[model samples]
Target: MALTVELDIRNPSGLHARPAAVFVKAAAGFGSDIRVANLSTESPEVTAKSIIAVLGLGVQRGHRIRLRAEGADEADAMAALEGLVAAGLEEPLDEAPPAAPVA
Candidate 1:
């Protein structure tokens, strides 16, 4: 079963390195064939599990991204990815933000 989802990237910087990495990581978590496409003129197809592929597509803020997954876990994969994109892919960086000095 293959599922498709479309979402707008609302992040100011668009899907940059950090969010792209998070998106890729989330996509890779499922045992499914995941792919993403840029809804631009080229409509380029990219591997969802590759940050480079996502970046290479030149996806920017307001661009629509389509995700397709085929496998047993396709539904779950779609849901997870949909949530991420809908939430602006605003995941916290793996490294914690710099701590402030105590008063």
Candidate 2:
């Protein structure tokens, strides 16, 4: 069975560089075969485990992407991915400034 969900990109910088890498890593953790298609860009669906493919979709902030996972773990994979997307792909910025160097 395949589980599908539409996720909105919330990262300010979108799925580029680190964000793409993070997404690819998460997708790889599951046993399911995961694929993603960019709804906003109308790009072809690609395997979620491939960083190159995910980046190739040209997903940007506010863009909605469809995620489909097929396998025994499809539901769990979809849930995890959905949470990740909702939380935004980027790590929260550290608010504290660097300490001054010792003289």
Candidate 3:
């Protein structure tokens, strides 16, 4: 399955080193292949998966980002990623307890 998540950049600092690192780390936790993109801008080279790629986006607060994950675990990856953005991209996905643990 392939899933796509539209993320609203809420971090005051945008996707800076810290948030980008956090996002990258979050992406790394999943068993699927994940990628992030800044859909609202003209740049197409800034992929959200790579630290350099995400940083290249230069996305600011209020920018809309598109996150895509593909693999057997794509659904879970997207869910966790949506949670990460909803949380302001501050806390790591694993750090937040799930509403209902996966069986």
- The most accurate candidate by TM-score is 2
Candidate numbers sorted by TM-score from highest down = 2, 1, 3
* Candidate 3 or 2, higher TM-score: 2
Top candidate when judged by lDDT against the true structure: 2
In model 1, where is the ten-residue run with the lowest total lDDT? 90-99
lDDT of 3: 0.77
Tell me the tens digit of each residue's lDDT in model 2 across 1-103. 7988998777766788898898899999999999999999888889999999998999977789999999999999999888888777656533354458999
User: Cα deviation in Å at residue 84, candidate 3?
Assistant: 0.9
- The CA lDDT of each predicted structure is 0.82, 0.87, 0.77
Arranged by lDDT with the best first, the candidates are 2, 1, 3
TM-score of 3: 0.78
Q: List the residue pairs that clash in candidate 1.
A: none
Q: What ranges in model 2 sit over 4 Å off? A: 93-103
> What TM-score fits each model?
0.82, 0.85, 0.78
